[model samples]
Target: MWSRELEGVCDEEYELDCPACGGGLFVAFGSYGTFAAAGDYVGRGAVGEEGRAELAPADPDRLEGVGARLHRAAVGAGRTQVARALTYVFGEGRCPSCDVVFSVREQVEQR
Candidate 1:
């Protein structure tokens, strides 16, 4: 079941840790575009490229099980942005520090 409280929280930008380097990463999909960065990347501020990795969104056609279901639900609700973010949630991310690519969902679950 989908919870309204969970939906509210899901709309906000959050953070995650890079599995390889244990660096704090800001996962955002706003004006800074969809990316995971270790430095402040919001607004007009400039950030260094040392720990910035572009998020590779999942392919909707390849999504399965819970990932597919959640993506469909968001699209059905007309929350396209959320749907896009969901793609990234199920997608892969690279650790800028270690240059290791890992599944975003799996890494989150490991923490």
Candidate 2:
């Protein structure tokens, strides 16, 4: 199962004003390091069900607080099953700097 966990803050905190409307937005670490939320961690995606476990923290960045242990019983059990894993945890939007619509990846792929 895939779980949404907190990592850390962005290396560089950036504040950009929307060129279209002059609205400003602060780009910082939301709840998780990779996620960027203006209000809450609406980016949490549950990889396990009630009484079920979630995935173990495979990455060091995800070992913050009480990490989840995901059971494999849920659907989409592998790295190839990313789309299902990121269903709720992520949102697609355009970059404030470049105005490029990009898919914000939830998991940091190991090289």
Among these predicted structures, which one has the highest lDDT?
1
TM-scores across all candidates?
0.78, 0.23
Clashes of 1: 0
Q: What are the clashing pairs of model 2? A: 53-69, 53-70, 53-71, 54-69, 54-70, 55-69, 55-70
Per-model clash counts, in order, read 0, 7
How much RMSD separates candidate 1 from the native structure?
A: 3.1
Q: Candidate 2, residues 1-111: lDDT per residue as tens digits?
A: 223232211221223333334434333332333322222222465222221212212342342232222212222355323322333223333343345443332322110
User: Any residue pairs clashing in model 1, and if so which?
Assistant: none
Q: How do the residues 2-104 of candidate 1 rate in per-residue lDDT, one tens digit apiece?
A: 3432342275445678787888777665555777777666557746676588889899989998789888998999998788878887888776767778787
